[model samples]
Target: MHGDRGLTVGGPPNAQSPPSAADVRAQLDILLASPAFDVPARARRFLSYVVEETLAGRGDRIKAYAVGMEVFGRDKNFDAQNDPAVRIEAGRIRRALTHYYLAAGLSDPIIIDIPKGAYVPHFAWRTEPVTDGPAATGPPPETPAASLPPMPRKRIMWLGAGLAALATVVLLVMVFLIPSRDAPVPTAQAPMPGGPTLVVMPFADLGGSPETKIYAQGLTEEVLSQLARFKELSVLGRETSRSIPPDADAARIRRDLGVRYVLEGSVRTAEHQLRVTGRLLDAETGAVLWSQAYDEDLRVRGFFAIQDDVAQKVATAIGQPYGIIARSDERRTQAGAPEDLEAYACTLRFYGYRAALGPASHAAIRTCLERAVDRYPSYATAWAMLSMLYLDEDRFGFNPRLGSPTATQRSIEAARLANRLDPENVRGLQALMGALFFTEQPVEALRVGERAVALNPNDTELLADFGARVGQAGDHRRGMALMEQALVRNPGHSGYYNGVLAQLAYLERDYERAQLLMRQVSLEKFPLYHFVSAIIYAQLGMKSEAAEARDRFLQARPAIFEQWDREMAKRNFRPEDATLLAEGARKAGFPVADTTAAETALRTAAPQR
Candidate 1:
């Protein structure tokens, strides 16, 4: 759903000779100059660059990362895995090419197209346009009527109607063939374009026994239920494909259900052993993206336990963020800023901001999400993303709009609205958990976090976020366990995971361990990272590094010095631990706490004790 979801997978090249260099250049020029290609300068430049590079035999170098930096003005830091700008433009360019071919370039000699799921441009000679003339470069001329035998008026009318009907059929076929992720979904029965889609076909009962059929059916249902827990995937239930045979073609599934991926499997039982084979297919090409065969000694584990374990493994491999489809989808490009604000698409924009947390992207995400919720007030995901953005205003000091609602209040309100709208949505619960944590409700926050994780344990980002929150709130063991599970599921996860892990180590007074973990943290603009590193360095007697880290932290979040205890409270440190951290901060060149403030703190603590 991110980009080019509908384009057909390119098959083998046709037997026709490849277009000559001159013809390829002519076609490129003609398409760019066509009235149908009303693309932005950046998209236009992207098209020209890729086409020229392909012609110059540099197609291998054309990738999302390269296109992003060279053509779209993104810096070297532009991560294609998170930023979808290049991919979105690729889809736009594909649509423009379709429009041009449908109207303006019907008779062009050479066809130049950037195939689906790639940045490389392909060139071929068009089979549709040939003339009585040899290799003409322009539109083929209309044959003179006098050169052909004249037919009766009635026969001519019939021929004209047949040609018109054929053209109508071709138009309809082309419309469905074009990738249209931003288009409004037809209905709930159809897969939403907000994410990649999959259909869990009924698993085949290869053994042809009653018990095996039952197991196959049950496993299929289990896989469906597990995948449905992931918010980013649109899974078609097995009931949608009950009529189709187990061996039905993947293209048939793609055509009927319009899904991008297909999961099909078979189970066999023999000699007290159970074997299951499963495959994940790219629906567009019927190519197997992933496949595995699992064997279990039926005597060792109970049948239901085995079923549950297999189902969970399948969901984790395919449905989780950064999982199979996500990684495959990420390889090219899969994001767009649609003209109309779909609530689901808005969630994707929020992720783009979450990846870097830069203020520039934050403002854009906030604006887009605000408009999305404004248009679709009932959208739970939009409310959830909005809640997180609001919390970041206080957490990361991102909000700059004056006279706005307080970030804490708005975050709480939005999180509540999201949960109210969709009680089971993990993201809604996550937003609520985050808002509660920031408001000094650590117990309630942990309670909600546990439920959120249980509701969708495959959500790696949620796992990492909850781990960071709970670890800071003092449940060190569970926090570390969850973070480790997340890392195992998604090793390419953002640097924030290690950054959080480094903080957990710092809190444990494992100065060397913290320093080691901190070395692996590659995050930018996270002030808390500097704060934790300063204290860890101070504890290790690295005074110069400690002072430098302290200065950077102060440069980013200077107000942390003014409300030291309050800042300590935000991290949910134990009272004694807070004092220890303060002492470390002093050693790292922080000013001594004011005498009046210290006296006020003591008097307040005297009663609480």
Candidate 2:
């Protein structure tokens, strides 16, 4: 007898006759031959094995461990949780089956589905539309009793006994197939390269107040910043790690960030006392490497001391030498009490908004800096950040309300005040360098940038930014070396950092390396990435690819070509260097205006030599 939609379910007593074993085997063969199984050889083999096992009444034995060893060539000792091969293959099979049912097997009478959260296969009869055709109008003509053959009573009894036995096996197997919660957790063996990499997750705010949240964030940043200043460690940036979900597991962290360790913490405050607890976990094993608790007065100095102590302990725990990690003496003194706390909290908020990279965020950063400076006029870091904010506005052509000239002037003034207030502040030096670079003093900018890098060679972010700026100022070799070291310290840095390296490569006339480096940049987030990609592709003589890249750039930044001169000037790129980029862009099919005219205009506007 046919099941729903003419599907022949296989089993049998004489009542509703199931499809024969031979018919089910034939359907399995058809499935195996379909395009759905056209994946890698191992995956195809895996799919075939699972289906055959289920058909042979061995479905309960189809666990991940068994599949790994049987089909994927994994060793007999393979741990399903530790090695993801089995899980990965199972996911591929599920997707392949879905693709098949949606396309090639849309009208197939039988459906085979692997339910998620378990690997067991389920078979169902596919429903088909009923038609009002003449064949269904009346009952079929009856056969004469003489023409029908009768079944033997012995054969009927044997078939009934076999069906009962098969039913009992299926029921027993179903019980054994229920998933167990005590399975081992998966562990990754891929070692983190170039020393240990750590991601500091945002601190949890247990204090339940909006004001207390600021303190938690500030504490996290303080610790992260201090830890990042060690040459022996590779630390992921706060902005990158903060995006991880609070409930994410160690496996997820390893998969997403490829870090060896994760630093997590929470803060609690009551009256004037504060408690901060932190723990470091092995990303591969989910084991706590080290943990510590800090109890202090809820004052800025207390917080700084706690951060310093924790950084030192974590470094020592991770096998870093004692003397190598910089002490927080100078920084702590420079960023002292009440006023520093308030200003630093504002700066943290400013950074949060800045990471969003929108016009509104830009405006918010300006507002935050304004308040910070207003509240603490002597806070050099706040003034330095304000300077950088203006420089960023000028460089990226953001916040057009503050015209380039006004932005440059403001940047210069803020940088001067920052440096005057704190002569040893590396951030102030960086701000001064940027402002000087934009104001047509490349020589001074290079000097200041070198000073900043000298003061804190272990600061990855500073090294990367300073390297990029100084490279633009004509010290390409030195700049590249600094950037290379920065990459070594922070391997999981954002795409923008890679883009800076790509630009340096382009300047050095290494088109191949430049093209390779550009791959790390996200074209959707940075249209300039596509523009540079177009130039590199053009230089490499890939006309079709170059044209495609150019189209994408134009689609994202429609007026970039027309605004090229203004952009170059705001970035303080040398006139000759600007001309080179413009020429390459023209060659790549960009509709850039004549740079010679802009060059002559610059010459006329310059003071007599």
Candidate 3:
């Protein structure tokens, strides 16, 4: 006989009779005691439930949803299609059965097999050896029980029997003492230390066309990358999650990746329109966290817009503040046309290139922003991006011809145009603040940066930049507070955030904390990181460390010392403040020059109220 899932039953002709009910029960107990069944408690429970149900002739009633509710403790209303716990467990159980048969149970007298695609188990007797082909048919001779060797003398025979009995008992005890060959090996779960880890699964292509498949794949990668930018969330890389089976259950994903949340979605492209639908689930419990559907015209801009919208929705679903939501809502209200879409698309490309940080990328960003502004001259966002591009080039030495003065003038003009186009443009104000700072208008820059923060406190980059600028302007305490708040909102913020905190610490004379904070900054990426660190170590009386830090700073940027002096002069620091920093650097073993006269003149020429 065979089970519905193609599992064979019964034994060979020479094999023993089929196992009784009690025998089968004993076998199950022994198997459960083996290492093969040492799975998660829930998986073991599921396996036992299905096997017992089949033994009771209830295999027909063992449906996916039934197993989910009764065996896995899921709600009675669990949807079998959406939550694939039963199917996933069935696969795991099948693998466990194979493991048992191949290793510990290889020579067992009976076999238990759970065939694919079914909950029923098939029981069969082990085959016996055969000596001849089908042509041979003969009865074998039996040994005579009455034939035996002559008995020994009574006393000697009794002594031999006693020793034999003792030896048999010892062998039985040894057999019982040895560990079972089929015990399950323990597996360690991967550590997930920070915020809950989430994996955005590759989106399914509902349209079925190759084009639609490529589009869906691209959308999935884009969404994954966008989610990674949020420091509040720990997102798994696309390479780790792209190949997840479409029907994989939450428990399987949790077991494999140790993730708490799974985001799955589908994309469909039709005639001139696209629709995206997504759902978030609690991977351990198979509970739906959130789901949404979006529809838009089928265009590149529309696709990007939907991708951004989905990422924002997922972040909000997981308890993040919906800052992007507010920004997008404001953009929609301000610019209600297709032209704004094109400009926003261009700005998105510009940011992508800017992050690349290559010379070609800088040129590409400039081109993108210039075209964006030309296409929509009144678009405040595009103008702001262009202004920021100029400032970045000047600050990072991306272009040799664009000197500080020329870059500062261009940036200020673009920022003014952006603000004039839209007074409520927060990004424009942010760019204008940077321009003002570079142009030696410290008071106005502080005012503008504060206004930008007031408009959007959730902008992590703005908060960090503003905090640094404000601290440099001699208000260390308030600037440190803002930066700390930003860290709370974004614990995984960039290294620059750490550098700002270190700078504030140095300003407050907290040498130890400043030293510790500076260690978090990348010296290669921010050469000034070493400068502040050197000053902190010198102040802490660590002469060797201070000298080493100063050497590293100079090695990274030999001209940084001169650049620093010029920038400090532009900021017009107070005489006492300049003296303290200069003295600290000198004590740290830096070759310092006299800037006391310049500092004195700036202090004496105070502007009238």
Candidate 4:
């Protein structure tokens, strides 16, 4: 029976009553009364399920299911016996047990543990006193017959065995009848403990012509890109996983990648048709999990149909191995209007602008994006790219023809428009942030940058953009951490991350470290790296290193005076920033007049009223 506040049961009512059912009850009362046993209601219910399952043992598997169904209301369409969700719930229950022991401050108490392969929980009394010998000489003098409980008879034992066997039969049937491992267990929704590893082997050329080979390469990249979007399966990188050599050992590859599964495939382009063969293998036992071949005539229908088939096959393979959370949201969707394609293509060209530095390069990118925006007025990416070009002009001193102070105002307007068009786009948000910070409106952008990160933690581009802006805004340490996370995601793409690291090294007053970074930099590969590296090394007292950086910087950027004039037009132009570049050239014994003249020109260029 139960009441509003508490309940009284007959079993083990007192601790000092010589181990009767009443005594067990009384010990439980003491445990419940203590402040140490304070657990939330949900945690308490989960804990209770564990306790009863352990006490009942093997014959009581159905009882475990009953408890789960009643507590969690999850038995519909789900078989507790074969479902992986049941096993995962058990794992969570195990962690909760550990939490209880630590949180309760139990110096000496009874303990329970759940064994693997069995859903039941087990309890053992730690507080029970140990006897020296196997049995006592005689029964207790004060023992009463009424208080003692009788042992199970042979008939009862037979009945329990029969029930246990029935439960086992049900478990076996459930395991066979279930179609997949993704079935949810009663009580809690939990993910499976493990999933498979998959690698997309490069597709073969199929003895095709040059144009066909290009199509084959595109097909190969498309498959990899789609698979990478799924978070459920571990996928090998494109660089490390293409072209599995003829003698390649699937078993060794699986072992090295720490995966239990491997996917191998080949593609052949014949006529205007594409034929593909794919096989999934259980690497541990050399068993084929699945194999299929697909043929499609692309010339009749177009390449889109073929690309769609490849994406579907990849999604199906990943879902089959890992129980069905894999999805293909990143796949491109064909737009109704042709201008969207033009805008996307333009964005790629603007991205290429990173390699091109100076007046001519920036102008070319601006022209390309301007035309794209003219064609597609609502194109989010094109507008954002245009904003970035304008912002770069002021931020990096790229537009020598336009005065810096007025150019910054122009950049601010462009960035605002970009943000207005595409608030969700990381590039757009970053462009707006740059405009705000330089225009003395950093507060909102910093807050929004942090919010953006919280929302998209896995996005490396957002992390890098946010890090650079925050570093420029003076939160050096936080900025460094954000950039480090970006590097961790894409290790080989170090151009932007390396430049930011060089700047951070300068901030910490580590001159030698700054100079070391400058030497590793390749300006031809990344022009901005050289520009930032030059200023940093120059300030760090490394004259030779600074001069090398300055020479490359000037070589890549010939319009030094005009660029300076454009930058000086921006608010909060620092003398030290120019000094770092100028003083380094002087220390390296280069003529100082050109540097000073450029600096003076920048300072003098103000927007007309």
Top-TM-score structure, candidate number: 1
lDDT of each: 0.72, 0.64, 0.64, 0.54
Model 3's number of clashes is: 3
**Least accurate 10 contiguous residues by lDDT in model 1:** 183-192
lDDT of 4 by residue, 1-609 (tens): 111111113222123222322223333333333333433233345555555443344336534466567555675655766765455555545544543455542432344546666655554444443423455576666857635653222223234445545754554454334222111111211111122357666666666555666666676787777665433345666765654564566777654444456666677776776777767666767776677788888767777677666755654454421122211111111223233244444554454465344566788778777765554443444555666677666566665344433555555555555555446655666666666766666677677677656644444656777887676566667878888877765454466576776776666556577666656556676775665666665666666776776777677655654555344333223444444445554555434455554465556664431
Clash count (model 1, backbone only): 1
Better of 2 and 3 by lDDT: 2
Better of 1 and 2 by lDDT: 1
- For model 3, how does the per-residue alpha-carbon lDDT over 1-609 read when each residue is reduced to its tens digit? 322122122212223344444445545655654543324445667777877887788989888888888887889778998887778777766655654666656645456677776777776654442222463456534766435432222222234445545644554354344222211111211111123457888889999455778778877886776566444345776766855788888888877666668888898877777777888877878877678787777565655666666555544434332233223323443465334244445554554443334456667767766765554444566677777777765665565343334666667777876776556666788789988887789899988998887765555667777887887778888889888876766564546677889878887888788888888876766665787888888999999999999998677556645665664655545455566677788888776676655456556776641
Q: lDDT value for candidate 3?
A: 0.64
CA lDDT of 109 in candidate 2? 47
lDDT of prediction 4: 0.54
Worst 10 residues of 2 by lDDT: 183-192
Report the C-alpha lDDT of model 1 over 1-609, residue by residue, as the tens digit.
Answer: 222122223322224335545556656665664434545556779999999888788999999999988897788889998998888788767855764665556655456788989999887655531222344377645877635543422233235445545754554454344222221111111112245778888888889345898889889988899999987677765557576676678987775555679998899988688888889999989889989888998789988999998988888888876578766665434454344325455566566577667777888878877776655454567778888888888777785544445787778877877776568988889999999999889999989999999998878878898998888877766777788888777776646777777777776777798898887776364556887788888889998999989888787778767777666677676665566667677878876484324345555798887
How do all the candidates rank in terms of TM-score, highest first?
A: 1, 2, 3, 4
- The per-residue C-alpha lDDT of model 4 at residue 426 equals 53
Q: Write the per-residue lDDT of candidate 2 for residues 298-346, one digit (tens) a residue.
A: 5656655766655544433332211221112113323653332444455
Error (Å) of candidate 2 at residue 236 is 24
Instruction: State the displacement of the C-alpha of residue 323, model 2, in Å, after optimal TM-score superposition.
Output: 19
Clash number for each model = 1, 1, 3, 12
Identify the candidate with maximal lDDT.
1
